[model samples]
Target: MSIALAAISILHLLDLVILITSTAANAWIVDGDLSADLWYKCTSKNGGYHCKQSINEDWLQAVQALMVLAVLFCLLSFVFFLCQLFTLVKGGRFYFTAVFQILASLFVMSGAIIFTVMNYAAASSSYGYAYVLAWLAFPLTLGSGLIYIILRKTE
Candidate 1:
């Protein structure tokens, strides 16, 4: 593959890795002895730790759904990129892949924003690595999408 395509592939892969890791981790917020994620809230109790299902808030559910959608869209975009790379004409652009990736970026951004806004009113806790990673993935996904849109198929 050409260097440009390889570079774009690597970037897309990196964004996907970040998205998956952030979504699955249990560290969106960390308090003194408690941590919360999309799925669960864990607390240190009696020298041990206990986990419970996250509160059933509509916004929280939306954030969870959006994050999952972002991961799926990113994965679909990668698959589309591979297929287009093999079959697309030399001058054709990866519009399909670009659209999917752009949507992925938007979904991730929306999820993160909602989480940040909703959590601001909750008990005091600092954002954790997973939260930071979700924000980090947004720009990477956006850049990858723009690259796809600008890139042309090459020999």
Candidate 2:
């Protein structure tokens, strides 16, 4: 039981880390020497790199907000899990934590889907690390949330 609990906690932490990194890293699209992310587009100029605000689009803004919300909800879920772990009686389910985590997963999925459908500028460029990471975090978070939903406190 202890080992399983520790593993779940670790997976949750990993999902949180991936969510943060994916949302913040500037690599959503990669072109020859240019890259773009949620917040900025960076291009390599003669011996240097220049970064500017990302394209102003409604969908892009929606993706940005969703990613941020996902990260926040994920963090909150973990905190709730810790609090519940100590306060809940044996056999109590971590429903609050599971809900938050599941919502986080949904937010991530929504953001990624929006990007996939709306990102026109990047049609020529290849998807970058941040894009891949966002997709990766989605399943991990969902799995963690499902694990929490089915898990019960045990001595």
Candidate 3:
């Protein structure tokens, strides 16, 4: 059993978990940021922020649902990766497994970048480390992905 292969799988799992957490956390961040703005804007007049205590329940719920689904997908992806990794250990080329793994990383990086851009000013209020891990993880994820592709069996 190649230790490096298992390590790669573990790293993939870790990235998957991070993606799930990032998704779920994004919902809270969005709600919190919006809620805080609403709170202050309610007190401060003159069209400063235009926030209200009674925010859009539908939008909030929708975002929450999206977060749940995103997390679920990430979890499922990890599970599938584990199964695939076990099979690859026995005798299998890193095929779709690597592709999916890379895709997951891409998803999270894109999500992080998008969130950072969307909440650019949130730093003043909250929304910390918008592009922190994504920036670092992107290249690592991409490099690992390329390694997997090159290591894959041609047959």
Please give each candidate's TM-score: 0.95, 0.97, 0.53
lDDT, model 3: 0.49
Candidate 2 lDDT for residue 69: 100
- Number of the top candidate by TM-score? 2
Q: Write the per-residue lDDT of candidate 1 for residues 18-130, one digit (tens) a residue.
A: 99999999999998888989999999989998999999999999999999999999999999999998899989999999999999999999999999988863457789999
Q: For candidate 3, lDDT tens digit of each residue in 1-155?
A: 46776776676666555544444332223333243321122333454545444344454344334434444554555566556655665345666655755665565555555444444345435542423444455565566566566554321
The pairs that clash in candidate 1 are none
Worst 10 residues of 1 by lDDT: 117-126
Per-residue lDDT tens digits for candidate 2, residues 1-155, read 99998999999999999999999999999998999999999999899999999989899999999999999999999999999999999999999999999999999999999999998864579999999999999999999999998999999
Off by over 4 Å in 3: 26-77, 86-92, 120-123, 152-155
TM-score of model 2 vs. true structure? 0.97
lDDT for model 2, on a 0 to 1 scale? 0.96
Residue 16 displacement (Å), model 3: 2.4
Go through the candidates in order and give each one's C-alpha lDDT: 0.94, 0.96, 0.49
What ranking of all candidate models by lDDT puts the best one first? 2, 1, 3
